[model samples]
Target: MALPLVPRAIAAQPWPALLSAAFLAAFGFVTLYSAAGGSLLPWAFPHAARFGVFLGLALAISYVRPSWFREIVPYAYVGVMVLLVVVLAVGVVGGGARSWLDFGPIRLQPSELMKPILVIALAAFYSAMPPRHIQTFGAIWPAGLMIGIPVVVILLQPDLGTSLLLTFSGITTMFLAGLPLKWFIGGGVAVGGAVPAIFPFLMPHQQERILILLDPSQDPLGAGYHITQSTIAIGSGGITGQGYLNGTQSHLNFLPEQHTDFIFSAMAEEWGLLGGIAVLVGLGVLLRWGTRVAMDAKDRYEMLAAGGLTSIIFFYAAINLMMVMGLAPVVGIPLPLLSYGGSAMMTVMICLGLLMGIDRRTRRDRERRRGL
Candidate 1:
């Protein structure tokens, strides 16, 4: 007879998720090692400490139950929204944007957390509704209202990249929850057309970015310097990198933000095409598993949450990769696992935990259905 599956085995171990997490942590340490570019000992200690903290957070999240995740969606959404408002009121300015809220010893970026919170809230809202009811106009307005609040607040922070991400993630969840394709495509076209007209309302720097994206050579040493350096670093890496820690672009300070947002270019410069592809493959694995979870989900909540989380991660990864590859503008979005930031690390870990919870619950519900 075939052996029965152990709960330990059947319960989601989240290995793909874990692998993605490790690749990020390892890449992070290496990037930080390159970031310091000189002090090996100090870089080693702090990098290890951050990796340990993220490790603990990831493992802790892996153990959380799905029901608990469901129960706390409303509370978490409210709390995160409050924090976003607080960030606007008294947040630290970084890269010409105030996206961080100070809380004594630690600073939090509610916008970072908002992506996942919006996902969960939308999932919960949709799950509570009757199947066909959400398809009607009545349900769509409240959902739009729910997402609009944060989108406006985040945009008021003048953070276009994150605001766009939040809007995309929320709408994606709604779409996955059986939102009509006609509405989705129509809304997309309208937004696409409206963006240019709205461009003038953006801050000068934001306007310059769009302009620069259209023609990167316009101000090569000014607003365009970052992408210019990033492209050079990536191109110089060629098929094989210059070798880790030996990237002249980063080590000599030609590439700005080498340790944080632009680390992909740094890695590409050092490890070349193969290394970059490895990171992409790891991310692909995580996405595939997330899609599986969504497909196997027992209810709309699990499906929507899993699908939304997947899209959030996918979009972030795509944007980061595209920016590094010179295929898109430098929108100042961080690579999900590879970028260095306490807020992003925590937010991503929490998201992984939510995914684990949904996957585990879905597996259990399936086994029970089979009377296993």
Candidate 2:
């Protein structure tokens, strides 16, 4: 009986996804340890602690029924929107963005919470809509409202990174819901055409970022410093790396946000191209697992929810990687699980927990069908 119970419990868990997360989190811990000048006091310990706590939260969430998520999504969305408004009114200003709500010992970024909730809300919305109405404007406008409203609020917070992330996740869901492809193509062309008109209205710093992206040397000591240092660190790594805890840029304080937004740069400096590839491969495994969950979903809600949630992680990782590599403008996006921040970790773990729950449901349903 004891032997049977051991395998049964082990078989019940999603080990592949769990192990992948563990690998990334452990890598992040070591990188953070190095970033702290070989100390764990500032960043390294807290990061590991947060991952553990959030992982537990995710596991608890995994046991929840899918119907419970569908039931709470509307209320949860409304609640988060309220928090965003609260943030605008009295939020703590950090890194030049008034995006956090102070609660004595804790500072919460409501925008992070919106990522997962928006996915669930949209998933519920599309799953309930009539199949015949999916192709109609009725499908398009309501979903747009769901996405657009929060985006406007976040922009008021002036967090361009979060706003862009929300837009991407929302649009990904809309596409997954079977919105016409021509709409996306037309919208893309229109947005592209409108960029010139939009350029002048952007904040000065925003304009500088775009300009620097086009020509980093134009402001080598100013707006382009972050990208310049990041590239130097990455390029210096070459093949294997400079060796653990021996990264010159980070240890010497030349790499800004070395423990957070630019942690990858620090890792590559010490761990080399191989370390970068290891991170990529780990993320790839997790992403492949997520895509499989979405494809294996039994209901429309589960499918959209899994796909959208998975896309949120993808966008976070992709934008941060590109931003560091100079392929995109700096927008302050943090690498998921690897960055030294609780808010993003919580949001991501919530998504993973929800995905786990959906995957569990999918597996059980398959077994039931087989039993019949």
Q: In terms of TM-score, which candidate is strongest?
A: 2
Tens digit of per-residue lDDT, candidate 2, span 1-372: 256646755688998889999899999999999999999979999999999999999999999998899999999999999999999999999877899999998889999999999999999999999999988989989988999999999988788899999999999999999989999999899999999998897778888889999889888899999999999999998899999989999999999999889999999999999999999999999899999999999999999999999999999999999999999999989998899999998998999999999999999898888993
Give the per-residue lDDT digits (tens) of candidate 1, residues 1-372.
Answer: 776576656445777777777876777677678767755444445655766786787667766776567798788888988988887888899878889877787877889888888888888888889978967987688889889999999888878888877888899899988877888899889989999899889888888877888777889999888889999998899888998778999888999987667889988998899988888888888889888888988777788889998888888888878887667777778887777767766766777777887877777777898997
Lowest-lDDT window of 10 residues in candidate 1?
38-47
| TM-scores for all predictions | 0.92, 0.98
Candidate 2 lDDT at 276 equals: 98
Q: Which residues of candidate 1, in runs, are more than 4 Å off? A: 1-12, 38-47, 367-372
Query: What is candidate 2's CA lDDT for residue 70?
Result: 97
RMSD per model, one decimal: 2.7, 1.2
